[model samples]
Target: MRWSHAALNCGDLDTTEKFYTTWFGARRVNEFDLGDLRIVFLRLGDAYLELFGQARPPAGETPGGDGHPVAGTVRHIAFQTDDLDGFLRRIEGQAEITLGPLDFSAHIHGWRSVWLRDPDGVIVEVSEGYRDRA
Candidate 1:
């Protein structure tokens, strides 16, 4: 089986949508009003990333995080592509990379990743790995 879509709760749905659309190429496929707020569905490749304005925070306390796994947590969702550098150039205005295109050749032969954030402070990882795709 293959992985499907994921959701990220945003404080401002329009802002988050604009950021992802501009930087990551997400396309809007559906949207619905929920009386007090709204929900938007975006398509990114074969996956869907849903945005909910009135989404409740996860149970229990979250440190300084924006209070959701998708909002802020090292458990970030990643995307893999062959043209890592080109993709980085396209994301120029959206975020600043914090980590690497650092070589992992010593540990793993075909793994390189760059980390950055979305508008809601959600970390996103873009990686390139030849072996895995092979």
Candidate 2:
């Protein structure tokens, strides 16, 4: 099967929407307001992120981390990029880059990754040259 989308709770829709759109080239495809909850769909190429507005960061989560993956809870989402350097340049001063531009060529051939925190402190990973080893 193929990937479709990931749903996340954001502190603010505007900031969350802007972050994905600007840094990841996502565009808003649909939105909804169900009285107390607000939602937005951001299409990034074939996959999209479903954002639910007004969520607070959990106390246990670090600003940029996997946050103790236990059971079925969602930890983070990773994206594959074509130009790692160019993507880094785009996020330079605009976003809070948590870590990397680290290489993992030894383990995964040409794999490399960088982490960034979303408005809600979700650690999102953007990488290039990642491949499955068989």
Query: Residue-pair clashes per candidate, as listed?
Result: 0, 0
User: All models: lDDT?
Assistant: 0.74, 0.84
Worst 10 residues of 1 by lDDT: 62-71
Q: How close is every model to the real structure, measured as TM-score?
A: 0.75, 0.87
lDDT of 1 at 25: 81
Per-residue accuracy of model 2 over 1-134 as CA lDDT, tens digit each = 99899998887889989998988889999999999999999998889899999777667746554333666766678889989999988788877777787999998888898888887778888999998767
**TM-score of candidate 1 to 2 decimals:** 0.75
TM-score of 2: 0.87
List candidate 1 stretches off by more than 4 Å.
54-74
- Candidate 2: residue 9 Cα off by (Å): 0.5
In model 1, pairs of residues that clash are none
